[model samples]
Target: MADDRRLEVLSAIVTDYVRTREPVGSRALVERYRLGVSPATIRNDMAALEDEGYIHQPHTSAGRVPTEKGYRLFVDEVARIRPLSAPERAAISALLTGAVDLEQVVLRTVRVLAQLTGQLAVVEYPSLRLTSLRHLELVALAPARLLMVIITDTGRVEQRTITLMGDRPDPGDDGAHGVIDPVALERLKIRLNASLVGRRADDVAPALAGLAEQAPSDERALLAAVTGELIAALRPDAEERIAVAGTANLARATPDFTTMGPLLDAIEEQVVLLRLLSGDPADASGMRVSIGSENHEDALAEASVVTAGYGPGVGDAVAHLGIIGPTRMDYPATMAAVRAVARYLSRFLAGPQD
Candidate 1:
């Protein structure tokens, strides 16, 4: 019975400390929670919890705050993470309703998520290597410039611009009329799409090579020129990127001038921020909650990360989305928001292309 009451006391302390951002006293716990106990019993429970290292006093005369271990226990056992309310779901849906394309959807999602979570939201762009090509478009914008648009089955659209030598003549033309021919462009689009559709980014170059080799005399050079640009655009190293928003939220939440530099610096570094999210192929459907020092990044030692994986395909495919905030944040609420946003993103990606 004593152990049960002590755990209850510890839970109250953690909850109050997270909400108030101050060490909670026995009297405060008694006033805030109906624990059905006397103030003397609550004080004794607080003393026992402090002795066991679950809660610690910040100063000689102050009350107690929960340690990382205490927060972990509260998160894993005591705290109940509830789902988003109907109004929140409607708000999220209303915010994301009219995005024009997948890129716009991904771009808006991070910002909407940041607003929803009230933390720095980061979302990794879906991996090109893992997605199959759905379509490809090439349009000549100038005598020598062409825009190439690549669309993938996972609703990701990537684009690149290429240049052709203006002085070169068509292979079948008798004159050096270097300007692009619309008829030739249409033929190239059809030829490229036949080979590229359903092919992954990594396998695209070889497929392009095979198609170019089997091409007719007048089309080989055009095919090779277009394929070169497509190969470069499809390189995973060149196109790997992420979306981030809500830096102002971090600035607003931070009060200590000493922590401002490292925290803001971590948010600005793309590689550092990308490594902070734990979702990948293996953790495609799981969540990673790294609290304080658990993140292993020295700058992030004073913060916590709540990441959840979101899938864009029907199979075992996914990308990561989550937020960063102070270690004393409300875990259950933040985790629930992250999870709800991830679910919404998955539905959007799985639904339709546009």
Candidate 2:
């Protein structure tokens, strides 16, 4: 266990350093924190902290900065999330309430987070397996060509077209388009339901055998298109992660041009960003904050992330929400806003009209 006074002093140093983006020294800490101890005593404690690898000096004579271990300890032991002010809360409510559709909600969420944190923000679309099948529509374009559309419980849409080849052209139905009888449409609906209903779209292969047995001539082509669309729609593309707002804010930090350029490139790499934010919730509820070097990626060494998991009302897939920002970010305010935003999203998506 860390000593109470020592932890207090360490927390103070971290908070101050994060705010100023400068190393914090014993004299400055004593002056600012009123630790009821002499500067020499604080210096000794600082030395001990450095020895324990919680803090380090950027140069021999420079003040100390928190190491990854230092940041982890501070977040786990001393961080306090402040609630948002009334005006801020009102602003958030207005932004969320104006969302006309699901896409708008997500896009607005990303923008709000970036605006608040001044760092890169990201919110991944919910995974497909968690979404229940709401509706499926099939339209016959010709005797053999068909178009299929599937809508999920989350309002995500997937569409595809299938083409079938036949040995004979049936030109009897008013032209060469052939016949699309009610029987064929009913059969197609049954095949779609069998393959997709109540099952994760990814697990529909075994069900395809039944479709093949009944519609052997066109089954393969139809299955291919349907399966392709389902997978494509459900999965997040590698490029999607980098599509974010607020890269300009990162420039305000005191990073050298070389460091800044690479950092920007790294942020544009969606795979790395997803991997960084991909951890499961640490506790049962509420929010989790990772500060500075506590992050796994070296590119995020100077940054911090605050995240949480939410769901849609009684039962739904856990939705991850949070902000990524410089370590100096206003934690209490950010955490409160993030929590509020997440709860609003849950309610908004679960409302009767949505």
Candidate 3:
């Protein structure tokens, strides 16, 4: 019972600190919260918490503020994450369902997250490595060019143009010119789809290599060129894209100018943001909270990152979406916002449900 009461006092302190951005005093806690204890008792609890490194007095005679340990305990043990209201849920669905393409979806998502949480939002584009080929289309654009469209299960589309000239000259054409035969093109399309559809991006190149070697002697060169384009389209370098919004929100949340510049610069660096979001390889379809010094990045030591994975299901996170803000954030609300947005995004990317 003593431990539970101390936890309650700590929770109250965190709540008051976040709302007022001020150190919480024992008298304030006794007056504002129904702790059923005297101010002296509360002070004793505060002293014990400070000794345990959960709360600290910033000045010699000031009230107590929560330490990182205190915040972590509040997030893990004390805070209750309430479900978003009906109106909030409706707003999320309406905004996201209207996106016409992947780019728009990501753009709108970052905006919505920023607006909803009043914090910097970062979203990693769905990684092709985690998605399987949904479909592949081959359209002849000209006598020597073909437009190849690659669609993934995560609603990502990549298009590449392939030149088939010099691979095989048409029967009636000179050696310098060639035209793709419709019948051969259709056959190659079927073969390529049969070999690649439903395969992950990492497995695509190997599968295409086999298909190219097995093609008819006249079609082998054409198949090889098409496969080469497909491989390039799914290269790893193209999968590292992310969208960010609400940098200004950080300024509003953080009053300390000393750390704000470096924090803003770190946010501008995509590599640092990606590393921050992707740090937990073992985190699949769960909310991850990295608070204060726990973030490891020097610039982010004064910030907290709340992230959630979005995708088809557990163990299959296509990517991640998260918020970055000052460590003194409202953990419950921020966590709920991140979680709700991630769920809606996962459902949308999974397409129409049966």
Candidate 4:
């Protein structure tokens, strides 16, 4: 365990330096912060901290800045995250309560997170597969064709058409007789659902093929269309939609946004963003602060990330939420705001019980 007094002093120095964007010296710390010690005493503490590699002097003439180790200790031991103010909480609750759909929920979440943290915020949409199956409707358009509509708990809807074989002897235009009865159609729907319902689209085809051998002679086309459409709608090839807000904030903090062209380029890539966010689900519960030079990504080597995972719990991360900002960004405020937003988002996504 670190010394409480030292940790408190280090925390105070980090908090102060982040705000001023300048190195912190013993004299400034002593005079500015009531450390209950003289400049000389504080100077000795600073030297000891520097020797322990918790802080560093950027130049021989400079004061000191927190090193990555310093940040780690601060985050793990010294940081005290606070919830949002009641008014802010109420506003966030109202905004989230009005979300009629998942897209709106995620969009609003990213915006709210950005506003709170003053840093870039990214939110991944909840996967469709995880959503509860609300209802399924089947409509027969022709003897051989049927349309199937699937509604999810998240309020999103998908429709697909299934083609079935016709019992009509002519197999074509027979104006005199309408083939396929309502009873048969209902039975066919029941059969198809037995193999398809609640299962992922990709896994449905093989399951449906099992029932094909026993399918009604005239409903083969309808079955095929229903199965094909369901598969297409849930296809993993569909681009996972994610919402990003606060790039403007990112530009405002950095001194040379244009010069960091490569870094900006990587941030824009969806795959890269997804990989970065989803890289470690286990690290999601509390705030995980990656200071400059501590991040593994080459593009973000000079940047800092303060992130947390939000889901059912730490083990079942439903999604990721975090802020990306400069290393000099306010850690305490940013971290507090992030923790609040993450908890709020998790509650929003879980929604009220039906």
In the order shown, the candidates' Cα RMSDs to the true structure are: 3.6, 4.5, 3.0, 4.8
Clashes of each: 0, 1, 0, 16
Candidate 4 runs further than 4 Å off: 129-132, 136-151, 154-214, 225-238, 256-259, 283-287, 311-315
Which is the leading candidate under lDDT?
A: 3
Off-target runs (Cα >4 Å) in candidate 2 are 34-40, 59-61, 139-147, 161-199, 206-228, 231-243, 254-258, 286-298, 313-319
lDDT of 1: 0.78
Q: What are the Cα lDDT values of the candidates?
A: 0.78, 0.66, 0.84, 0.70
Model 1 lDDT per residue over 6-34, tens place: 77887788879878888898889989999
Better of 3 and 4 by lDDT: 3
Between candidates 1 and 4, the one scoring higher on TM-score is 1
Write one digit per residue (lDDT tens) for candidate 3, span 233-306: 77887647899999889889767335688888988988888878877553333888898788888988889999
Whose lDDT is higher: candidate 2's or candidate 4's?
4
Can you give the TM-score per candidate against the true fold? 0.85, 0.78, 0.90, 0.78
lDDT of 3 at 198: 92
**Which residue pairs overlap in candidate 3's backbone?**
none
Compare the candidates by TM-score and give the number of the best one.
3
Give me candidate 1's TM-score against the actual structure.
0.85
Ranking of candidates on lDDT, top first = 3, 1, 4, 2
